[model samples]
Target: MMNDKSLDIETAEGNAQPPHLNFESSFPSENTQVQTNTSEQRSAYQWYVVIICMVAYILSFVDRQILSLMIEPIKQDLMLSDTQFSLLQGLAFSLFYAFMGVPIAALADKKSRIKIISAGIAFWSLATAACGLSKNFIQMFLARLGVGAGEAALSPAFYSIVADLFPKDKLGRALGVYAIGAFIGSGLAFLIGGYVIGLLKDVNFVVLPVIGEIKTWQLTFMIVGLPGVLLALLMILTVREPERKGLKVGEDGQIVKASFKNSVAFIKTHKKTFFCHFIGFSFYTMMLYSLLGWAPAFYMRNHGLDASQTGYILGIIILVANTAGALFCGWLIDFFSKRGYSDAAIRTGMIGCAALIIPSVLFTQVENMQLSFALIFVAMFFSTFPIPASAAATQMLTPNQLRAQVSAKFLLTSNLIALGIGTTAVALITDKYFENTVMVGNSISIVNAIAGVLGVFLLYKGCQYYRDSMKTENLSKS
Candidate 1:
């Protein structure tokens, strides 16, 4: 049943080798290339790489989402409308985060992923600090764009690198831990930003020699942004790029690189899996950012809570529930696989999607603050439960050279739709459709209910395709 072109190769040490990066030219001799392919020869530093990559991911979200907590200050400072602020939060950042990902991901497929990651970490971290320096709309928008572009470099490379470092059986869990970074960074953005702003609320703005006066929110951005720069140095000095694995090598032993046309062509051969996967998650993301971007304001408006109180409650729920969901289900994917469920990740994702619907819809419709928070908390956990499994499944389906590019495609579609449309949909329903700000809760309910159902349908349809891909993979290995 195996595709003849997809069989495993033998290593110089006489052991079966998994598909790996074509580094034939770099090796200079066939014997050297074969020797490095052995599982026993893998670098001992792999787990450290995963930990640090997760840190970078955490920092990316912190830099990106910090604006969520600082919305009121940004509005007051710029004398801006809600539309203008939303532009900064959604469109401005997402444009770069989406388009810039492809080229960077292509580079990761060919060059030093470690170097790419370090440079990205430094770029985004510095860009986040620069956000504090901007005095006006155009300047701040550019800064946010820079943050997006820099973050675009991280996940594709990290996903590709992580897959090679972790064996297939363990990849779901490793990626699960990596996926926690997004939620962690998101939660911490609110926690750290709220705490910092609260601490500085009574203090007068400080005037610096060149930068002039800085507000409390501005200072918060600068302080949180600097630590990631230090972390970038650790990545460069400590992490070694693992030997690439699970790729198709050519007859001459040359690792063929993916071109845009070819990659699309290859993806089409498995269009059902990719399309269902992309569209499903995109809708899932629509529901997610709808709550995330608007929920704090919703609480403050309806429940008589202040910014600090809203941040504390939402932050704790996001961190604990998302972390638990990602870790537990990620491990569960591997566990199911070992128990003869070849499509375990897809099954887990389907379950998460189904579970997410009711809680996601009800959380917004409820009037009681306690009930609202509890519903949303359960929704957040289930919403995130699918990410690690989806990520690992994507890697399992793609070849080594194409992994980053495909992963980039994954991020681009999900974020562009999520950040671009998800937030806007809720706003449109409230501002345009109902013509009443008080109906924000109803708007959230309508949008999430539709999107959550669609997400469940697509993920369910994609399950068999994921299983088919796994069978193809197993056949290739045999």
Candidate 2:
């Protein structure tokens, strides 16, 4: 339940004059009376918002993952090495994506979130299509950088919208639903990309006079990129911006704006939750980046499957396990919070997941292909199960006004540390152990396991912070 004082402040928007900047509120107060329908009506609208955001998110992942499917074809055509491929996959995309998220998030906070999201969809979609036109490694790398830049705007805006649409109690479920887009988009990219590329193999199309005939992979990119344009149009037409919360003038007559300095101050004041979330997100990205970026290649080389077959099998695992894990984590977090164990849910989930990952990684190194596939599915399930908890914890720690910026900051920190470092680290390790494929596989398992353990410890600390915060709030009320 919302605090009575908070609700009063929310309702008194027109009655109370805006507070001045000199006000000493530790957190920004809810000032805007967002035009919302009744609870039942708003509940229905929230679902609609979630659906649209999910589609946008789906498109984002589809654009991001398509490159991995084309890595082999691109490498063969461009005459590139694994190291070069790794740069295209990780560093090139992550560096710009990480840096761009902040400014994009700031824009989302200040502008219409729907517009930012729609523009991002179109931008990344075009960038993906551009990938098919690249003549060399450098061109492909630059195209990927564009794709990353576009994607950097998505999650922060989407998260802020979700927070606005749903109440605190229901936010976990909403966010979990949003997270499913990651799985669905990634799974579909592999499944559809493989089939599309297979059909287009050795085919020629006269799409452009200057470019003349285009091959299968190029056509695949163009086909995939075109759909996002339509999705972007839908977002612009359908989604409405919610009223900004926590931007109200308090009794002191000051209007609150969430600035970068304010965001940093909030984190500094909540250091434990801040650092724990950062570390947890880093480890999460390490596993996800390594898996998504390289799993298809792993299947092609180790399991002796063609791209299409590998994509289908992996898609099945992702569709099933990732969806289930996301839903399960949301349900568990809410349930545990009701039972007075808010942070325990996340801590327990991560620790158990870490334990499961060790064996899953070991099994992935097994020579038997069937056993390896089964283990990979198990690994993916456990690996993603804590995502809801981690996301929820981040949202819970920050005030409403700074939600987008904080979420973007979280992504920025995590991406730099995890996606940037994790994928590059795995590639370097694989290259170093190239003389022994067994050692390469083993090294990935070891690095991921160690990271998972560290994540567990961080989550425990997050739990402590959460508990202390709750106690402090309770005391203040008393």
Worst ten in a row by lDDT for model 1? 4-13
Per-residue lDDT of model 1, residues 227-320, tens digit only: 9889989989988877888885655898666666656765787888889888887887778787778777677667887777777888899899
Candidate 2, lDDT over the whole model? 0.75
State TM-scores per candidate: 0.87, 0.86
TM-score of 2: 0.86
What stretches of model 1 exceed 4 Å from their correct place?
1-44, 250-254, 472-478
Runs in model 2 lying further than 4 Å from the true structure: 1-39, 202-210, 246-255, 348-352, 436-440, 470-478
Residue pairs in collision within model 1 = 19-246, 19-247, 20-245, 20-246, 20-247
